[model samples]
Target: MTRPLALLALLVPVFTAAQPVAEAPVALDGTHQVDLVSEVNGHPYRLYIAPPEGYAADDTTRYPVLYILDGRRTFPAAVTARAFQDIYDGLDEVILVGIGNGEQTFDAWFSHRWRDYTPSANAATDSVVAVQFSQDPETVVSGGGPDFLRVLREEILPLVDSAYRTTGDRGLTGQSLGGLFAAYVLFEAPGLFQRVGINSPSLWWSDGETFATEVAFAEAHAALPAHVFLSVGSEEGRSMVPPMERLAEALRSRGYDGLTMDAVVFADETHTSVVPAMMSRTLRVLYGRSE
Candidate 1:
């Protein structure tokens, strides 16, 4: 499996040398792209969109939409994975939309994610908020998740749903803190997305406080109205995954209706190398045809 660019690497120097000297140009079999600007709550965001393979200006075939967080860093790989699975495994072709920081530079994009992906400092998620990118306080943005989701629900989703043929079946994919945000959405706005692929979620964030939120959600709702695909590297920090297991067990014990969920730990994958296979596997489980 190819390594997905770890934003943490871009922020921390110890992982700097792992990055390639030069970024290769992105090439794909069937893809389309558009750049968009969104101003929500005084914050401007950059959105990079890719409609499904063979999309037409006048076609009425509504397709599933996949919203990828950290678009600048993850879009190319997602486009390629979507196309490959759509063809080889007979998965449904999807509308791919990448949400990026308006800033095109890596440092800025990486930094901005900290602000957009983390939830606000509630008593629950504040105790363990450790800013890793302390060397540059500027790179460590946190607790702006609600505004970011608003941009998606109110701005980006409406734009695509209006312009393209869409089924309104939305799926979200993100890593680390982005994964944490996705998990938050599962409870906070369970109706917003139909499918979610949360890879290597930083459950360690805030000492995995989200686990309590999930349990509370399960108690409140009789059914979870989404398909969820969760994954983590087997070697990810020991504390990172046990919470996910407990979460899965809790959900399983509830027997919630309309919910099909699975969590897998890739045997040999690490945080930096899990995303490509993670996305590929996640798309298959979420949308691919079963044998």
Candidate 2:
């Protein structure tokens, strides 16, 4: 049926307006990206920086910096989680920094993470990972965590500190392999971060060498002055849950002074699905304001 001329004209404009139009991408407010090449590790990294609401350049307030691993995926999640907590739970405001390898593809990012997160090289594990990803074992490089930590300490942290108004208080959080790196940092340089979140850490990495690191830390120090949140999914199976529980127990058994540790096993969440809950709870435990 043909419509009247006036009706057709009105409908035409509406339909035309409703059609899809290409527009410039909208960026998150108060967020920016910085590309950095680490002098310590010679690895290029992309940092996703998000300042707290009402942050101002001239403001005297210096916020704590929360460094998140796997920034390509976790940065947005961390930002959302923090924003929600800030609104509903009275969470303290802090700067969020996401450390990414600057890769755009999954395989490339995976390769970088595999190289950067492991503490020791294991040919067996490398073969297993390569098979899982359908790649050659020799191509999968493992163990550059010490150098990665050096990159953060000598390069990333210093850059972030100089670029922003930040306090000495720092928090670090990572999941899976990234979590393993966080644990490594905890034992190797506990003083670098005041708060840490180890979410579903791949403690199985390198024959559970992180356990040995923990032992070394215990031998060297009588006290651990840090707030640590350790969490895992109940459904993550033997590889994840038990080691996390064991680590928690071992840390508790030491009775380390000034150590505020909170460990939880989230019900029915899988390794991949537990991240949102892990990030949310980690923020609350690590950054919640005192009432």
Candidate 3:
């Protein structure tokens, strides 16, 4: 099925659902499940939005939102852990927004994530699962990092701002490959997000090139205005530490007057087991509440 070059041109469908359903909560905290849908350049998007523990309809209290990657799988656990923290800390009130595929999980998470997070399309990029899983060519979504951010800026952020009493201070988070992507976004769009929490980031991807770029950006720039929390499993892999260290060192060397960074190696956690604890700690660190 060799399609014509004209049809093969860049005319992505931008598969998107309508705005999320802010339905009445089954519980009083407005902690119900919601999904935000949007599109960029014809590519559809669906993000998970989890309201605060006691999301009162009439309280009119603005909350900080956490934009999570791989929401389909992580949302449930995050919700449970958040509930626990809310009880333990007695101050766990915030929104958890999980960003993932609407109906196409693979594309929403992997393909689209790679395109939007990585700074380069080079085949040598590491920490990325796209090259290992991508299948379709027409539906093959890639190399739209900036475009994806535009969708977040134009479509998603506006919807969040208008619908809820949001503080306009958002946090971005992810695990493994997703975590690496978070680092990419932090450097690429410094003004968009205020905090980023990356757990077990796949810095090994891209041949450790992201560090050099990040260093260059920090050196050339005047100031950084966001806080970064990067953690990794000590026993995960040997190749992960140096790059992570380099990222922190780069920030320090370049002088982060406004940046608050905490990079730790969790000795007892694995790549897959660090998300829950990291989420709790990251929430506390970024939002100023802890359990």
TM-score for each model: 0.82, 0.92, 0.77
What would the per-residue lDDT of candidate 2 be over residues 1-291, giving only the tens digit for each residue?
456877888888887787676988656777889998888777799999999996897789899999999998888888988887777756888899999977888787888899888888787888888989987566688978889988999999999999999999999999999899999999889789999999999999878899998998899899888999999999999999999999999989999988989999999999999998998888888989877
lDDT of each: 0.76, 0.90, 0.70
On lDDT, the candidate that comes out on top is 2
Off by over 4 Å in 2: 1-18, 136-139
Residue-wise C-alpha lDDT for candidate 3, range 1-291, written one tens digit per residue: 556755655344333534678787353243444454455657666666778856778897888888887776676667777777677664446788776655555554556666666555554333234345654444444456567678778987787778788887888888776778788788788868888987777787657766876877867787788888888877677776666776777777776668888888877777777777777677766766654
Which candidate number maximizes TM-score?
A: 2
How many clashes in each structure? Answer: 2, 0, 12
Error of 2 at 85 (Å): 1.6
Instruction: Supply the global lDDT for candidate 1.
Output: 0.76
Candidate 1 lDDT by residue in tens digits, 180-217: 88888888888799999878887766667788788788
In model 2, the clashing pairs are none
Ranking by lDDT: 2, 1, 3
TM-score of 3: 0.77
Pull out the clashing pairs in model 1. Answer: 114-141, 115-141
